[model samples]
Target: MRVLIVEDDAALAERLAALLGEAGLVAETVGDGREAAYLGCTEDYDAAVLDLGLPQLDGISVLRHWREAGRVFPVLILTGRGRWSDKLAGFGAGADDYLTKPFQHEEVVLRIKALLRRAGGHADPVLQAGDLSYDTFAGRFSLHGEPLALTAQEHRILAYLMHRKGAVVSRAEIGEHVYARDLEPDSNTVDVLVGRIRRKLPPGLLVTERGLGFRLVSEPEFRD
Candidate 1:
């Protein structure tokens, strides 16, 4: 899964990204609130870490705008403001959870994991679809109670697809979330990767719509 980190403090953002990476999450960091707001609205992040004191726009405004735009992904507020009123305002602005600064890194990770689980409709820490199970914390996938071997790219692709289970995700959307900001991806890389992933998955688990994109479904689909 991928998460967006919006913090003006470059050090903190990078640190959080590193921590998220170690925890099996792909993290995209943006130091500007306006940019964060834009990405938060446009990107398909599993969750987001938003700082209240942002440069261009405050975190509350960003959250409000994202909510207004129908961005339903979970957002956790990370801020130095400890006042109860601050938290109340954040909740009012549509933040799912709040964390004051100087908190534990473990807490942050746990909060994000909780948000991810809820967002994916998972009642447990492990994300499961039928016989397919993925341990989000370990970045390991299991099929029919056996470990499924997958390359890093393949795992990332599968994780994203599983998170958006029934939605038709385009190759472009997959690329945006799977690839790093500095890496230049080939036009058909996602397609190739999806084909590779499909080989390992059970037949009919992954489907491609002629002109749209790919989707991970719980059952087989009827072809014309």
Candidate 2:
């Protein structure tokens, strides 16, 4: 999943990005709230970690603007204020959850996971495709009930693909969802990752459309 972190604290934003990355999620940060708001509305992110205090534009207004524009992705408000009014305003403005600052990092991760599950219409965190089953919270992929070993990059690619199952995802689209903004899309890393997935997954799990992109098939192929 790709997440947008809106916070002016450079250190804190980077720390959050790293934490999300380690959890098999892609993240990008914007120190300015206006740019953050622009990206939140323009780009596709599974969720966001938005701070109440921000320069250029306050986080609350940003959230309100997104709601006004009908952008429905789940957003978790992060702020130092723990008052009831603060939380009420956040939810009233369309936030799915709230988190206080100086909080445990794992708490933020957990909240995001909940939002992802609810947003995807998944009653449980487990996602299944054919012979593959993935634990969204555990970030593990299993085939035929046996856990499959995958590199971090492979895991992220597969998770994103599973979420968009049946849709053709281009190389650029995959790169955008799986890697941070700093990573170059021109690199062959994406191709290599897909190749590795083909090797790891059951045959026919993934198929490529020349000049189109790639899609995930939930049914395994049988040989005659």
Candidate 3:
């Protein structure tokens, strides 16, 4: 899962970014609303944490522009504006959820998870791919009832794939979601990371699609 945080407050932005990162999601931050709007339109973010008050452009405008551009990623408005009108404006501008300031960091993470689940058409917090189980809320993976430990990069790649399980995902798509804006992955970076994940998973669980890309299957016929 990839998230974009658009907040002007440095401390708040850093804190939110760190919290989201700990939740096994790739998070990137931009302090300006113009930049946020551009990134939101350009990047393949699963969700966004947007602040209403912003520099260069306002959050409402940024969100409206995104919607006009047909960017349908879930957006949660995290702002100091507690007025019902502000929330209405956010919703009218195509926000999926709203949260006020002086909020709990855990709640932000939870809301983002719920948004992701709903966006992916998953009502449950846990995602199943064959014998592998991924707890979206806990940011943990278990295979056949055993815990599966993975590096951060591996986790991002697998998480994105699990969210869109059974569908072929290309290397370009993986790079967009797994890596942040500043970290442009090399040609073989995704291949290497997916290789590591394959080592950790059962045989045929993650399969390459030849000229296509990769797919995560919920039912894999493993053979020796």
User: Best candidate per TM-score, number?
Assistant: 3
In model 2, the runs with Cα more than 4 Å from the true position are 187-189, 221-224
Better of 1 and 2 by lDDT: 2
Per-prediction CA RMSD (Å): 2.5, 2.4, 1.6
Clashes of each: 0, 0, 1
Q: How many backbone clashes does candidate 3 have?
A: 1
TM-score of 3: 0.95
lDDT against true structure, model 3: 0.90
Clashing pairs in 3: 130-218
Question: Where does candidate 1 stray beyond 4 Å?
Answer: 42-44, 181-187, 220-224
Alpha-carbon runs more than 4 Å astray in model 3:
221-224
Ranking by TM-score: 3, 2, 1
lDDT score, residue 12, model 1?
90
TM-scores vs. true structure, each candidate: 0.85, 0.87, 0.95
| CA lDDT of every candidate | 0.85, 0.86, 0.90
Candidate 2 per-residue lDDT, tens place, 103-133, comes to: 9988888788778877767677888778899
Candidate No. with top lDDT: 3
